[model samples]
Target: MKIGVLALQGAFYEHRKMIEQLGAECIEIRQLSDLTSNRFDGLMLPGGESTVQGKLLAELGITEPLRNLINAGTPVLATCAGLILLAEEIEGGEKPYLGTLPVAVKRNAFGRQLGSFEYTGSVGDLKDFKMTFIRAPIITAGHSDEVQTTAVFEDKIVAVKYRNQIGLAFHPELDQDTRIHEEFLELCKSFSLNK
Candidate 1:
């Protein structure tokens, strides 16, 4: 399976490495041509400056195309700042991008860089899931019933599955555990066959 990773900016390399380790072709999507030329089974949005990524996406003419793909039921794994892009709203009134996932996110709710932490908690069905947070955003609220809350940190929603899109407030790709990526790749496999 081939996965297209948004490489405009962020921890995209980390995501790419994880995808490769899982036996998938990882394509770095830096421009509109990258998206148009690729036949990827899934999309990965890694943690980074959400505002900058959003600006570059629009400037590079990739916002609409990427959104369309996600809206068309393409499997996507969005983490940290990536989660901010997909949310329907930004909790503090910052702009929203993509807006494919029906949840509101509070950017850097866990604090700045010095506030980052690693925790072992339940993520979806993985009870002992370990996740890393780096200036992560928290899903404050869900705007649709389709948004199924999967994992919570400190009683706040950290992960959710909305249809084919999976949003996470923590960096699963940053860890050695491949469970989350494996699950997403399985979704991609199913989607590839069905599509």
Candidate 2:
């Protein structure tokens, strides 16, 4: 199966490598043309600065198409800033988001870039994953009761998965372990067969 990673900014290349490691063809999506022409079973939006990523995505005219695809039940794995873009509302950001998930996010919730951290945790479907967080945005709230909090930090949710969508406030792609990617591959496989 083919998986597309948003390569506009941030650790997109890292995500591409991880996805490729999962035995799936990887597509680096930088332009709207890529989104239109590519046939992907799943997509990953890597961690980055949400405000900048949002504006950059707008400039590329991919925000809407991505939102549409996810709404149509396309398998999506979003990390950090990518998670922020998927939220329905951001606590304090003027930039528009893709609004694919029913959650509220607080940008830089983990504090500044210097306040970044590396923690060992069980990321639900993928256990014992060492997650790296750099200026991460935490999911402050989820409107739907169906939203399942997958991982937590000090009792605060850091990762969640609902249906075909998964969001993480940490960088799973940055880790050497391919379990996260493999789990996403399973999500892709299920989504593809069911769709």
Top model number, lDDT: 1
lDDT (C-alpha, whole model) for all candidates: 0.93, 0.88
lDDT string for model 2 (62-180, tens) is 98898888988889999998998899888865544898789998888878989899999898856678989999889999989889999998887999998889999999888798887
C-alpha lDDT of residue 12 in model 1: 97
| Pairs of residues at least 3 apart in sequence or in different chains that clash in candidate 2 | none
**lDDT value for model 2:** 0.88
State in Å the error of residue 145, model 2: 1.4
State the TM-score for model 1: 0.98
Error of 2 at 163 (Å): 1.3
- The true-versus-predicted C-alpha distance at residue 148 of model 1, in Å, is 0.8
Candidate 1 C-alpha lDDT tens digits along 1-195: 899999999999999999899899999999999999988899999999999999999999999999999998889999998999999899778778999999999988988999999999888888798999999889999999989999988898999999999999999888899999999999999999999
